[model samples]
Target: MEKDSGKHPLFFVTERLEFPPVEYTNEEGLLAVGGDLSPERLLLAYQSGIFPWFNEDSLILWWSPDPRMVLFPNKIKISKSMRKVLDSGQFRLTKNTRFDDVIDLCAQSPRKDQHGTWITQSMKKAYKRLHEIGMAKSYEVWEGSELVGGLYGIDLGHVFCGESMFSKVSNASKFAFIKLAQDLEKKNYKLIDCQVYTPHLESLGAEEMPRENFIKILNEKN
Candidate 1:
């Protein structure tokens, strides 16, 4: 994957846990910039397709952007008014119970033109230590005992890397992203990364692709 004389890679990773080969990223897909999100460097940065976006006043910024923005969990797109708001069950989905109140309300939601929050506070204690070693998760959309909507990510078995979402009312984050994409398409989960690009996740069906075919589906072993 050669090409790296333009200076970008910088993850000494406390003496190398390694991560500089997504074609040695640079033209804005950054690559590395001082790592330490340690859940073994965020599971070796999503097993090398890489992640960790910046902006709690910058500096810990690694990425692998290219065309990325995935979704594929059985092509998730249920529009007829979101299937009548999931058959009007009136929101009450939960997984991983509360995940520090759905990542403290997705680090205090609010990001149209963006101003702050890349879910910082050491990325919420390094994703609550990758949700206490299970590889990070959280999808709550309750409305009974309150907690409006939710989302959280990084589940890389077959990739579920979402990362952020919030909503206090109106459709409650699209019913917590359509019940986490129909429960990761009943566990077959080939993808969901949605790393960048938004028209609200391209109207629920996320698309984009090539970063060398998403690192060839992140070097599949699932």
Candidate 2:
């Protein structure tokens, strides 16, 4: 929590692999920088209510934003149209079957206003490692022989920290999300961290809570 001039000092993680206290983050939620995405470091980051989110050319930036966006498992909203889509059985939902493909597609999918993705090659490899150890999971949507949509994230006991999702067709990702949420609810998961605001997530019942409250849940549940 050391201060530099009038601002908090950003910690440069090394072989020891540590982060400063989350309270040391600036107003933008940047907690630290320059940490390698080793599995241990990544787990520590998530368990501490922080996540890495920098573009390929930027230094590794860890963030713990105030007003964190999250969705309770049981609170996921499925509109009537979505319910029909679910019942029609047009898409098949599976968990952890094609994580590598899922993440690769997410990286390739374009965002409306964003330029380039934060899911860099290194980040994908790190998450793939996490998946190998069973700490990370993916929910994939398939239409016959083709993979269409999916999402992936870290599963910390009762919380799922969602990272990214992509869809090749309309409602594909939403179907994947709703299925995952329904499944998590059955398993008694407490929350799914959406990390930030999006109208899409808001429509599906995500709400922003203070960072302190989010951390409390992380500590208490996971």
Go through the candidates in order and give the C-alpha RMSD of each one to the true structure: 14.2, 1.5
Error of 2 at 13 (Å): 2.1
Worst 10 residues of 1 by lDDT: 1-10
**lDDT of every model, 2 decimals:** 0.81, 0.91
Each candidate's number of clashing pairs is: 0, 0
Q: Which stretches of candidate 1 lie over 4 Å from their true place?
A: 1-30, 35-61, 70-76, 79-85, 92-100, 104-121, 125-140, 146-149, 152-162, 165-174, 178-193, 196-204, 210-222
Distance (Å) between predicted and true CA of 113, model 1?
Answer: 34
Off by over 4 Å in 2: 1-6
TM-score list, all predictions: 0.35, 0.96
Which prediction has the highest lDDT against the true structure?
2
lDDT of 1 at 183: 84
Candidate 1 Cα deviation (angstroms), residue 111: 25
Cα TM-score of candidate 2: 0.96
lDDT of 2: 0.91
